[model samples]
Structure formats: structure tokens, C-alpha cells
Target: MKDLFSSYRIKELELKNRIVMPPMCQYSVEAKDGIPNSWHQHHYVSRAIGGTGLVIVEMTDVEPDGRITDHDLGLWSDDQIDAFSKIVKEVHRYGAKIGIQIAHAGRKAQDAETPVAPSAIAFDETFKTPRALETEEVKGIVDKFRASVRRAVQAGFDAIELHGAHGYLIHQFLSPITNRRDDEYGKDLTKFGVEVIQAAKSEMPASMPLIMRISAREYVEGGYGLEESIAFSKVFKEAGVDMFHVSSGGEGPIGAAGRPGTHASYQTPLAREIKKALDIPVIAVGRLDDPILANSIIGNEEADLVAVGRGMLRNPYWALEASQALNKKVAVPVQYERGFRH
Candidate 1:
């Protein structure tokens, strides 16, 4: 039987355990230039030292206007690359694989003169109603995503995950309610998502894995459902996506139904369904705090990986503690050895 601590390899990267520090926005970057500072470096380095198998960096905007918050990290230029490279090296020293989630906020971009999306839809009260993107402008966003992937590879990240989920740029395109364009982009729901994957792949090293974070269900009327999400997964697989990071909600009409409440393994069923439909590995996320529940998801073939966000934020050594509870040995940094022994 495979244990949670069992090593798993995807392409050239090998995870030390099944634990993944799922991307969580820190909102802790330089506002003007969106460069990662010392705070970002130390935060991720600690997680690496805490024995996380894969430390996925927060959602990094591919362009200035793509930022969801004023303090989001970005990789739109050469200067930003140097700043992020420092943290990548530090995380690598702790023996963990690093991945960057490159994204565009689209209509969800906050505090911008004119946020761009497939249509002119506002995400919420906090965000401004976005300007519908022109066809030429849409092409520019694709180029930016490709460029960002190149920068991430140059910064020495082991892999890059395209931030397609969570009501971001790709989600804006995927949801019918948000994407009302009559052109090529909206006519084919899967077209834009597949293009981003291809563009990112083109800029990255051939051996490096590319994961697509997807909102498996919109959980609202006239929005993407499980059937459409499953069909979309096929397009992603054909586009060379190595894994599917399954998440739900965040892209729907105001006050939609079926939004999963905060509960243990709340989103595991989405992962299970997607995994059943696709051959690629499925990563389950959302309120996955308990080791028993995580073990059950993996043990029952529900998901190949479990991503813990708030849980890990509250406890950097959550993976280590969970491993101990499961009677498995995990690497502990020398500095934390005393606490681990106790």
C-alpha cells in the first residue's frame, strides 16, 4: 500500500511526499512594482524547511493590470525575475520542489483603470466592472502569459501552474455568464483555456511539468457544471497538462447554489469525479485539514494529491505532524528537530 509519504514523480520533478502547499495569495509584495520582498522569501522558505513536498507560490500576475490585489506578486519584467529567483533558490536549498502559479485577474483585477475580460462583468463589490477586451488586446494577454512562464523558468522554478481557476482570468473565459463574446474566444469555451496551456508550455522547459488549476464547478445557474468541466479536462490533457488542481465556486452569478461550505474534504468529490473522467492526476483542495480525511481521499483513489491552503497557513509543519500521526517519518529541518522530538 502506498503511504502519504510515498514519493511521486511527475516528469522531471519528484515530490518528497503527497503534501502540497496550495497557492494562497499573500498580498505581500511591493505595490508599485509587484516584486516579492523578504517577507515572501522567508514565508516560502519556512514551508520548504517544514517538509512540504511541493510549495506552490502564490498567484503571480502576468501583467500589471492582471493583479487581483494591489500587493500581488508579478513576473511581467526582467527586474521581477531577479527578485523571485532569490526565493526559488532558498526554497530549493530546503529540498522541496517549487512551482509558480502564473495568472491574470481579468475582470477580477482590482484597482485598475480598466480591467480586461471576455465581457464587461464585475466580479463583486470590491472589484470594478471590467472593460470587454478587444480581440487584439486578448492576444496581448496570451503573450503576457507566455512571457511570464518564461520568466518563471528563468527564475529556476521546477514547474509552473497556470492559474485557470478561482474566478480569475481563465475562469472568466470558462464561465458563460462572464464570457458573452460572439467572437472566437467565447464561441468555443475550451479554446482560450487550451491556448494558455499551450503558450505556457512553449515558454517552459520541455521536461518541467505544467499543472492547470481548474474550478471544477461554478455552482451557479447557467455556469459551468461537472459535465462541462470533465469535457474541458480532456482538452487540458491533450494540451500537455500534467495535473488538474480541482477547486470549486468563485465564478458564478451573485448568490448561486451548491457552493460547498467549509468542511473537511468538501471538494474531494469534484476531484474524484474528474479523476474518474480523465487519465491525468487530480489534486483535491479546499478545507483539507484532517490527515484521516486526506488519507481516505488518497486511499480510496479519490485524488492523487491533496492541497492544503488555510490549514498550512495556520501550521507550516502540518505535513510533518500529519505524517507522524500516520506513523510515517518525514524530514525535519535541524533547527526544528527539538520540537519534532518533543
Candidate 2:
């Protein structure tokens, strides 16, 4: 009878509750350099005050050009580490574990520099056409990932999640529609992902949990399918990924079909299937607005954890309210107790 309020552990990390706040791009950074500021602190701190068990920071670029937008956060230099450290400390003070999503936007990067992908492909009209990365430069991107992981560790993050999904850099490599290179990287999509994981693991402590957010299905022609994702999951497991955040359908023309809709647990099946194929934990996300549905997925072993994105955004106290509905005790900030007394 594991409910939404039940405690869960992934690797050595313990989550006070099953409710997790999925990373949502705030696009609130100060400038193209991607340095985190007070806005990020206030944003995440508000979520922490809302009683989320875990709050995964938004996607942060490992390199300057890896940013998806000019306002995305980054960790390419030592100066950024202090801001991240402040964020981690603030979130932890509220009893919420904080994790950072380190990523490269790849072909999706937009701004001063042209984007780089496994092949020269464009994301959409809003996205800039990217140049294919050279072999040596690709290795540099892997190094950048390792460096970012090190910075996250220095910032005292509890875990690190590789942004492998959402039609970003890693997704670009994973998707056949964009990754048309014949080299080892483009020829074997799994290899590139494995390398990134290996690099991150090498830089970060072995005890720290490593999760990969992957689109289980591209939902477009010639894009990644569940079968390929399952295979990729196996490789990730062997490479020491602690969990898989199963999200889908970010790989087509911009605003293509399969974007977020009203369906509850739209990507749960992918998590279930991947979890069945691998021994690691799977996180189900997308339209998980109902606590009953979230509890059912966990109770039935469909997913080990449920991530709520827009749902939590619309109602940061969604977890606390859910606990109340399920007859479970939830901690409320003393100042807010009066508001909930009714």
C-alpha cells in the first residue's frame, strides 16, 4: 500500500515523500552567460516551501553554447558554483532534496554562437540551424559534462540528472531524425549517451545518484522508439544510472503532435516498460495531476516515482493537499498553518 506520501530511496538518497517537482525551464536567468541569480533562488525556494520531497533544478548548460535559450542557467565557470551552492543550501533547509539537470542543448541551442549537433539539423523555425560537431569537439562536450558534474557536486547537490530527453542535445543524438552522422557517435546513438554518463560518473562521487531523463518515444517518424529507449536504458543501467525519468515526444517539428496534453500519466507506460527491462527505478511524468492516479502507478509498480511539472507550478502545495486528501500527515510551514486550518 505504498501511497504518494510513502518514503522512497534511490541509491543512497532518501526522499521524504514520493512527490517530486519535475524540472521546468524558467527562462529567467540574467543573460546568455546563464549565471543563476536571485530569481532562481526565489523560484526554487518557493517550491521547497510548498513541501515537495525533491526539487530538480531546471536544465543547466554544461557549456556556454549548450544553452537552449539565452536565459538558461549554466555551470561552465567557477563563478557559477557559488550561486548553485546557495540554491542547494536554500532548498535543503526546507527539507527538500535538490538535484541539478546538467545538459547540452545541442542542435537546440540558440543565441550568439551557432548550435552544434551530431549532424547539421534545425530544431524549428525559432531554432537556429546547427553545425555538426567535429570528433574532437564532441569529446570536448563530454569533458564539459564531466566538469559540470564536478561543479554540481561542489555545489552540494544531492544528485545529478543528465538531460538526455526533451529533444535537447542528447536527444538530438538519440533521435535518428537529427543524428544523421556516419561516425561512431551518429552511427551508434547509445554510445554517445553512454559516454556522457561515464564522464559524469567519473567526475562525481559513486555514491551520488545519477539519473537520465530520456524521451521514451519520439512520437514522430524516424525518431527514437520505445525499443531503442529500452535498449538505451540497459546501457544506462550498466553505466550506473540510478533512475530513468521517463518523458516522451519532444523530437519533432516545433509544436508537433505529442506535446503535453490533458492525459494523466501520458508517459507511464514507457516508464513501466523500461522498468520491466531494467532493474533501476523509473520516474513517471507528464500530466500527473491526480494523487490517486500517482499513487496507483507507484502502488502497482508501474513507476517508482511520479514527477509533477505544470501541476505543481499551478499549485505548489499540491503535495501537501494530496497528503491531506489521502489521510496522511504533511508538514506545513508554521506561517501557512493558519491558512490550511480550515
Cα RMSD (Å) per model? 2.0, 1.8
Query: lDDT values of the candidates?
Result: 0.85, 0.85
Q: Tell me the spans in candidate 2 whose CA falls farther than 4 Å from its real position.
A: 253-262
> How would you encode candidate 2's per-residue C-alpha lDDT over 199-247 as one tens digit per residue?
9999888778998998888767777678988987888889878899998
Per-residue lDDT of model 1, residues 73-145, tens digit only: 9999988999889999999999988999999988888867889889988876777889999988888888999
Candidate 2's displacement at residue 246, Å, is 0.2
User: How many clashes (backbone atoms < 3 Å, residues ≥3 apart in a chain or on different chains) does model 1 have?
Assistant: 0
Total clashing pairs for each candidate: 0, 0
lDDT of 2: 0.85
